[model samples]
Target: MKAEKKPIVSCKGITKVFGKDELAVHALRSIDLDIIEGDFATLAGPSGSGKTTLLNMIGALDHPTSGQVLIDGQPLSGMSKSQLSDLRLNKIGFIFQAYNLVPVLSARENVEFVLRLLKVEANERRTRADAALAEVGLRGLENRRPSALSGGQQQRVAIARALVARPRIVLADEPTANLDSTTTGELVDLMYRLNQESGTTFLIGTHDPRVMEHSKRHIEMTDGQIESDIRA
Candidate 1:
């Protein structure tokens, strides 16, 4: 039998509140979850349902008002800012709906930016960046700037950038929001393939049915709490 996978992410009694007193908004209410290694999961809910807020908490982009989170067995609440930054760089990758890329940088440079920040040597960075771009099907577009690429290509570049460092987990927030139906399908398919091949855990926040369909697990939230969790 295959060895049982471990939980790569865990949350307990997570509560996130913004503001205070009368103006307070509860973004997450006592959330409890675990994402096993290599799981392809989607957090789905309508607007104001706290999907993004929960994703932010999981990605260590925001702090919860109460409770704790653990990534790769390390407690997030105990980490300092620098430690958190290091954790993000080494263990986690983030992909956003906006496809944040430097306008002046070509696709290869964009993918190499993370490696540069990690102090990777130029030669290795270039090799890894090129390999990542090719993995995402952007082999010949390495010199193209973001403006020259279509939305899907740009998103693929973002994926390449995220995967270049070989992060254990990838967090994507509404990654398909800017793409058309066909592109969205392709993007999710690519992500699924990557998860299958690389065993990279994926936790995506999206209301898109296409994204949900491609994920192996579905977690639906409402009023800052998980309403359902179904595994395919």
Candidate 2:
């Protein structure tokens, strides 16, 4: 097999502490991580093991108490909130356990939301939203509202929404939790194909065995520290 490419993201000696002094909680110990572009990697650990904390820091949703996070060689520490939001909007796609779609909006409209935020032309947004829905196998269902779609379909729409902006990184947090085994497999396969076709980097935080088995790289954490990093 070919060697992995240079890293698009690097985190060095990352540390996150909650509260302060005597009541402090060390959510994440010193951590060093490198994620290459197009890498489909999973962060696996039990609850409170710092997997989520690390992911949050990488996504710029939270800051570390010490150390630094770099995306495409740009340090995150000095970025303003607006700059961080701009980075997230342009470079990161997020998928959560909950299919957080608006009940009143159709799937197409939901996907169009991000493009709207970016001030994309209405016609172009419509075209891209439809294409994204079709990419996720939700073409005809694009007219349906979240309430009208099944759990799996709703998640697929959520995925379409995440990808509509064509962000560089996709951060998924327990995306399969609400899915059945079959649907879980389908979703994972879809994401894998997307990674191959679009070179979109995936950083998933999950405890599911299926996720661990399917990912190209697996990083295991324990007690707020990474125990192992392996590539298949």
Candidate 3:
């Protein structure tokens, strides 16, 4: 049999500078990074190290000042804003520290929102939303609103929303920042299970030791540049 090929995400000579010439703040400087599909990786850095800037570029939330970013061989520069939005909707999942759930929407509804946006059939949307909630251990609390749910449960709902579409990549920024250690561990374990079983790749940006411990590869940044990339 032929060897299995690695799916690639590459950033070539990427640079991002804010402000004008003399007062400019260089957030990322000529970053050359590659993350293969099915990889579990963490971006570890101190504040102002441009870890989030690099992630934002990868997530299509921001453009690089110079160079290029390629996802699955598609150049980001080749995409229009609408095309990027479509790509994000269909191919990327975002998990943020704040959970970002709709206050008025129930757990199931929040997950259903993404399905609806994807134009999933109404009936199938409900079914898939329920299943996604169940996968995140919120099966019995589907009717609860964000205010009624605990922080961990709310984050689980956010995770469900992210995973319901089965995106190829998950970009998580400080996802466990608000959780206790126990809940953080549970969340990490769940993500690992999903990654292993579904082959979903995770690219997490975190400063937490817990995240580093669970990551297969950890890339550390400092002063807006990659200081080291380590595989554990």
Candidate 4:
């Protein structure tokens, strides 16, 4: 029998509230979830259903108003701001709804941005960035700027940037939101392949059916609570 995988991230009774009583927004309410190792999971919900809020908390970009989040067995509540930053830099990769590439940089340079943040030497950064871009099927386009690339290609560059650092878990917030049906399908296949090939953990936030269909796990949220969680 195969050994059981450990949870990469675990949340307990999570609640995130913005502002104070009488003028407050409850983004998450009593959320208890775990993202297992090497899993491809999608958080499915409509707008204001708290998918992005939960993703943000899991990515360590923000803290929960109440409850505890543990990433790789380290609790977020007890960590300092700088510690959180380091955790994000070291353990997590992010692909935003809008491809967050710097317009001024070439595709290779954009992919190299993450490595540069870690103070990697210029030579090794170039090599890994090239490999990442090639892996994402953007070989000859390495020198192209974001403005010169199509939306799908731009998103590929973003994916290259995200994976170049070989993070423990990749957090995608509506990765297919900006893509067309065809591109969405293509991107989904690429992500699924990458997950299987590299055994990288993926936790995506999306309402798109196409995006959710390929995931190994599906979690639907409504009114700041999980409506259902099914693993296949």
TM-score of each: 0.97, 0.95, 0.96, 0.97
Model 2, 146-172: lDDT tens per residue? 999999999999889889898878999
Model 4: per-residue Cα lDDT over 182-228, one tens digit each? 99999999999999999989999998999888989999999899999
**C-alpha root-mean-square deviation, each candidate:** 0.9, 1.7, 1.3, 1.0
lDDT of each: 0.93, 0.91, 0.91, 0.94
Q: What lDDT, from 0 to 1, does candidate 4 have?
A: 0.94
Ranked candidates, highest TM-score first: 1, 4, 3, 2
User: Per-residue lDDT tens digits of candidate 3, residues 8-43?
Assistant: 578999999999989999999999998878888999
User: lDDT, candidate 4, residue 13?
Assistant: 96
Q: In candidate 3, which residue ranges exceed 4 Å CA deviation?
A: 1-4
Error of 3 at 177 (Å): 0.8
Best by lDDT: 4
lDDT rank, highest first?
4, 1, 2, 3
Clashes of each: 0, 0, 0, 0
With a 3 Å backbone cut-off (N, CA, C), the pairs that clash in candidate 4 are none
Expressed as tens digits, the lDDT of each residue in 156-217 for candidate 1 is 99999999898989999999999999999989999999999999899999989989988899
